[model samples]
Target chain A: GPKVLQIPSHQIIDMGQMVTLNCDPVSNHLYFYWYKQILGQQMEFLVNFYNGKVMEKSKLFKDQFSVERPDGSYFTLKIQPTALEDSAVYFCASSWGGASAETLYFGSGTRLTVL
Target chain B: QQQVRQSPQSLTVWEGETAILNCSYENSAFDYFPWYQQFPGEGPALLIAIRSVSDKKEDGRFTIFFNKREKKLSLHITDSQPGDSATYFCAASGQGTGSKLSFGKGAKLTVSP
Candidate 1:
């Protein structure tokens, strides 16, 4: 039962400020991902990072959103000059490698409220 | 394109009753079909999953029936309990090795006593 932990479970930021949401994934996981879910909408794929580089991303991953695992500690998602539409539940997930099998372990998620 | 679609925005069932959730998808290469359960303020946890090679996979009260030809699936919970209430999402992913989850809109299930 591996667990993914997220810091600052909730955050409120101004419309033009920067916010960094953090995640600590399972120790043995090699794959990492970020997913966003707007209120009352399905969870949408954002971006994925592994081996210190982005492997793939979806259309929803915007320029304002950037992910980094500085010092290989915390996987942080930073939003610069946040907009009203930036508000959503951002989730972090990690999984072990598989030829066609990536079983993800997700965090509780950070609820971002951009006002 | 939206690869996955689930039915019933919400559902309510009494204790000891059976709950069935349906889902459909557009991707033919998607080999893994999984169902995730989410409580009020928690993350979605993997409940049950099935591969295209299998028609059914059962674990405890949760069962996943997958039809690869139709690209459809269903989750059946037998003798449901109140603790089983949660938002259930049907997800599908292709033969990739990363976050290729094409998720459905999700279905909310509430089991009352």
Candidate 2:
């Protein structure tokens, strides 16, 4: 099965500090996505990127958040000046295409705790 | 607003019994529905899926019964086992919506063997 690998299974950062979460998506995957999940809550979509550009973003994608996959490298999500409410598990997922039926391969997720 | 909704926040079923999980969606544009299974400390994985065109889809012990008219669906796990214990999330997407999936607050299932 295809695998999406997330770096640093857990991260503890102080509020107002910047944090970067890294993801190594499936090699052949072209579309990348980041989702946030709080305990016992739904997985909320943050943003989706394709062709080096952001395709769509949800309200949860705050202005402080940014995503980039520099030169075909690891897709990264960087959050500046993190807030306490930003504490959640962030899962990275990738798909070969953006079609409705395309399957998404997700990483185990990075548990970010903003203290 | 939640585009997808699921019932029974938590359920416990005994082994060999059938467990049914219900889901509904608010968007009429959604045509693709997928069920994802997640265990503790792990990301959700695609367990089974069905399209709006199909009324039923079966895969081994797992089955999906869809009602396009009512905008509802259900996943039935027969002959459940302890390993089947996990949180199941119902997700929806549509052609015009690209691949962004709207997921429901998952239903946690506990299978007692």
Candidate 3:
């Protein structure tokens, strides 16, 4: 099975600081997505990106959150001046086509802790 | 409000028995349903999926029974094993929704040997 790799499996940052989570999606995947999951809760859709543009985003994607895949490198999620509620496990997923096309491959996840 | 709902927050079944997980959705526009399995410390993995046009889908021991009119579905796992203990998430997506999936809170299953 193809795999998506997420860097820094665990991160602890102070509130109001900027934090970036990186994901290495499958080499041939075209669509990338970010999802957040609080402890003992459902995974919530945050945002999806395609061809250097945001295709869609949920309300959970706050104004402070941004995503980019510069120069075909790692896909990154950056949160500036983070809030305590931002602490959660972030999972990155990738697919060959859009949501209706194929199954998504998800990374192990990056656990962000805000203090 | 949660668009996707799953019943039995936790379930316990004996090995070799059948385990049924129920799910219902509030959105009639959702045409795609996918069930995911997640173990501790790991990301969710796609177990099986079905489209609105189909009433049932089977893969190995896993089967999904879909009722389009009722907007309900269930995942049936036959011959349950201890290794199958994990959380299952039911997700739905509407057409041209840009691949954004609305997921249920999940049902944790424990298969005892």
Q: Chain B TM-score per candidate, please.
A: 0.95, 0.98, 0.97
Candidate with better TM-score, 2 vs 3: 2
Ranking by TM-score: 2, 3, 1
Residue B68 of model 2, lDDT score? 96
- The model with the greatest DockQ is 3
Ranking by DockQ: 3, 2, 1
Write model 1 residue lDDT over A53-108, tens digit each, in one string.
Answer: 88888888889889999777999899998999989999998888631476777899
* Reference-based TM-score of each model: 0.96, 0.98, 0.98
**Would you give the TM-score of chain B in model 3?**
0.97
Q: Using TM-score as the measure, which candidate wins?
A: 2
Better of 1 and 2 by DockQ: 2
Tens digits of per-residue lDDT for model 3 on A19-103?
9999999999999999999995799999999999999999989999999999999999999989999999999999998877678
Question: Residue A104 of candidate 2: its Cα lDDT?
Answer: 85
Q: Which CAPRI category fits model 3?
A: medium
**For model 2 chain A, the run of ten residues with the poorest summed lDDT:** A97-106
Q: What is the overall TM-score of model 1 with all chains considered together? A: 0.96
lDDT of 2 at B48: 90
